[model samples]
Target: MAGREATNPGDSAILVAERLTRVLPGEVPVTLVQDASVRIGRGEFVIIRGPSGSGKSSLLYLLGLLDRPTSGRLLLEGEDTGTFDEDRLATTRLAKLGFVFQFHFLLAEFTALDNVQMPMRRLGRLDEAAQRDRAAQLLRDLGLAGHEHKRPSQLSGGQRQRVAIARALANDPVLILADEPTGALDTKSSANVHDILHDLTRERGCSVVAVTHDMAFAQGADRLIELVDGRIVS
Candidate 1:
């Protein structure tokens, strides 16, 4: 497998799908994603937009390797993903991908710092002190320094979401997949989240592929892909 080129930030495609499709069992199998093909390069900010039942979320799941395609092939970092077993896929996801969803899935029982450190702890690469340090640093980087010790319930919606972002970065993933990450926040918080995503792509050179229904949000991405009826319409 070839690693993405380190030349122009957007020159190397980090994620690629060829004739990708997903089938769901019904009376007859229904193809939710139909012959979809997409290539998102490193540092690219790509938005997947669509109406309800248009398969936007389905497409995102495939890209994030959370769901397997029923047909065609997917390549991550130029490595064919079809051959990978579930364990290999899990490892790849842990090492290469980060995700932020519409809701902040922070553990309410834990403080923001503890929640952010969960991934590092699972990976077991850092000692206790090192994990704490990295978690605190990530929260600080996401502008949640003051909220580290606070529980999710004590923090504002925006702050909680920021903590989730920090948690996503805990593994330093090469790609971030966000499913309406700011959908639950106010306009201000949404903007803040948007800015953080953009900064990650532009500054840290991470590829960001977001699934959104907000036109305002989609317009800001480097590329906007429209999915309708399980296919790319634009």
Candidate 2:
């Protein structure tokens, strides 16, 4: 892995990765990501596209702080995360980052509103009523205005995905990291998800980093980072 390069002094980067590498050990070690470096500015939508097993999702996990790098540094809002303890890292993730996965992952028993409120409740920045109100507003914003009370099982595939997106926004994070967010949806649903995410960058100034195989989704991003065999090829 190469050393970190100096970024422009005036650059307004929200997230940065310097020579990020992740390795899993076994009889023979395997590297999932290798010397990956990227920067995401506020309101920028970046799409990571690559063939399967190219480490797109692995890199996303490292950037999202869901997984630690084996040998590299990740900086969030210009702050180095190398010194953060596990608890601090968890707190940072809750306060600064949001995530949407291919699977909705909503609690099967919880209503859309309740699922969206989970993050707010965990953060404890709002009272019960306030959380509910905010959650309702997010669902409405995502075009699920009347489906708040519906469980994941009760909603259509697209609606359920929208509910998941609403849940991702529950904490009002500065950056949204999505892993194949539209992979499970039909064409129409995928387009809807793409539009919603793009609108978020324009209207809310939220940075987005999405790993996707969909060319249409990648085309809509401000920048596309292409990877090959665990390395960025473009």
Among these predictions, the greatest lDDT belongs to: 2
- Checking candidate 1 for backbone clashes, the offending pairs are none
- The residue-level lDDT of candidate 2 at 72 comes to 84
Where does model 2 exceed 4 Å of error? 1-11
C-alpha positional error of residue 139 in candidate 1 after TM-score superposition, expressed in Å? 0.7
TM-score, cand. 2? 0.96
> TM-score of every model?
0.93, 0.96
Identify the candidate with maximal TM-score: 2
lDDT against the true structure, per candidate, is 0.88, 0.90
Residue lDDT tens for model 2, 125-227 = 9999999999999999999998999889999999999998888889999999999999999999999999999999999999889999999888767888888
**Candidate 1 lDDT over residue span 7-53, tens digit each:** 22346888888878899988999878888888888899999888989
